[model samples]
Target: MTLLAGGTDLMVDLNFGRKRPERVVAIDRVPELSHLEGNGHVRMGAGVTYTRMLAEDVGSAALREAARTVGSPQIRNAGTLGGNIATSSPAGDTLPVLAALDAVVVLRSKQGERRVPFAQFMTGPKKNVRRADELVVGAEWDDAGPAQTFMKVGTRNAMVIAIAGLALVVDRPRRRVGVGLGSCGPTILRAPQAEAFAAAIFEAHGWDRHLTPSDAELKEFGRLVATAARPIDDVRGTAAYRRHVLAVMGERALARVWSIT
Candidate 1:
């Protein structure tokens, strides 16, 4: 079976001695695995690169924006969505976007093929998974509501890792909240409380009339996002600071979605 996806993690791991697999099958140049096709449920080849993600007009704006934040034009050109999941990085820029969209991954082996949800695919930090003989071919996207955006806090921009990152997908239809933290904890996560809270808050404020949410409500929603984070104090930042960033990011995300000052 082929182990393909941007090769960012696999190549690095092999080089750094973090991991070494005896038998390696590359799918980087496979035409069938490099195309992004399908509708209603967007089916992407596991080999589709980040550059493809940034350029796609079909997917949500949030995903495109998040793709823009990935390593660089070079990295985006090389990285694949399947690679992001294979790396099992909680801070993968596209990961939270996938989670917020409730994406499904297609895994195949000599035995057969199975579809797994993004949430279930990510078992933990730097984990979840494929056996020695299994292949992760591609992933499919679902619809996320309107006015979605992605934000991340790092030492700098361009190619820096996320100290804490968030993707807010807002809509009256499929309201979802995906928060991805880098160097914060084990895995990327969906903020259920924050999602539910934001939905209720938005419902209370009314999505149809465009009523403004009060500062208190906004701050509370921010707190919920913060509460959902599991950041840690590392060389780059502190847990408290990470929490603060989550709140500020969440607030700004909400504001940006609404185009409020």
Candidate 2:
């Protein structure tokens, strides 16, 4: 059965004649799918809507920030994080955030439950590892208290898909850095080199909350992020444009997070 939650993705496909499913199962009312819990490590029900994410602390500031950029208010009220994960759109706003956070995706089926790292969950654009009989129950991650931010280059200020996007997470306590790329590759990608570069800077700066990275360091970090991206020209943007934007966004996001106390 085709799983249905917020119907934000599925309904669009239906309306556009892109999908014609013979049957669908509405999983939105499943109690287990609607709860959001935890602190040290957070669990967010797969059915959690973007509206709920913004309404409540969803464990990560990066997630909350990404949730706000999903779509218009009405769409946010209806779109579920599970749906986004399952849909596996390269442009899905929250996927990069989840990847950057290194979240775990909880998949359940009659066979049993299995946990997969977010990085391994999606194989390519609009493709994932979920079996036909399995359902996405929720996702979880250890809380990395960091100054985090999400930014995307869309055609408009709102209600638009990303041309190229990036999620920057600075876990000062752990002396770690994460960079998640969106709409710039076949799947959501993490910039390991950039992350390592930034983390080294954090280490050098003693992970100081008040520390501001030098302009040269930030530029180098951005360059690394851009280099990590494997983008293709699409209707939304050219590959070269995406690379340039990713670089700029990487530096911009890092700057914003660093400015936070």
Candidate 3:
């Protein structure tokens, strides 16, 4: 049975004659998968749309920012996070935020329910770990707090696919840092080394809620973020250009999140 939520991706392909399905199971109306719950780890139902995220406090600064980078108002209203996760596109704006937030993908089937880490859920571009009978119920992750940011570099300012993207999350109280890269990798990736470096910087700064790293530190962090990516040349951008832009974005995101000029 084909699972359908919001039908944004499915409809796009169907309308363009890119896909033809004999049958589909509409999951968007499933009440269990249509609500948001939990506080520490916000659990968003698969059917939740970008418009709803922006309209309400979806709980993560990075996620809300990423949601804003999605398609226009109409698309945002119709496109669901479950669709984006299930579609597994490299340019899916919300995936990077999920990665940085260390999200858990919740899957359900006739057999039972299972949870997969966001990193392990997506195998490659348009590929994921969900079984044929499994349905994506939702995603869960801890709040990214106020210091998180999501930035996408695209050919156009709006309604454009990202050439490169970055998501950064800083938890001052926990002195933790998270980084996710998008559009420049086969699947969204976290820069462990870069995260570690940033965490150390946060500690050195006394976990200052407003601490901003020095220029040299930011540069090194950006370099590490670039090094973590395994990008390729594509029509949207060249591998070299992606690396360069990601480096700059990493620095800029850090500066923005930390309130640095």
TM-scores vs. true structure, each candidate: 0.90, 0.97, 0.95
Model 3 per-residue lDDT at 31:
78
lDDT digits (tens) for residues 70-136 of candidate 1: 8988888899877886777877887887777778888888899988888788778778866656677
For model 3, the local distance difference test gives 0.88
RMSD vs true structure, all candidates: 2.5, 1.2, 1.8
How much is the lDDT of residue 83 in candidate 3? 95
After superposition, candidate 3 runs with Cα above 4 Å error:
259-261
Clashing pairs in 1: none
Q: Which ranges of candidate 1 are over 4 A from the true structure?
A: 1-4, 56-58, 175-183, 259-261
Instruction: Give the candidate order by descending TM-score.
Output: 2, 3, 1
Model 2 lDDT per residue over 1-261, tens place: 688999999999999999999999898888879898877789999999999998646888888888888899999988998999999999999999988988899999999999999999999989999998888998998877758889999999899999988988887766778889999999999999999998887777778658777899889989999999999998999999999999899888888998565
- Compute the lDDT for candidate 1: 0.75
Tens-place lDDT per residue, model 3, 128-162, is 99998888889998765678899999999999999
| Steric overlap count per candidate | 0, 0, 0
**How does candidate 2 score on lDDT?**
0.89
Report lDDT per candidate: 0.75, 0.89, 0.88
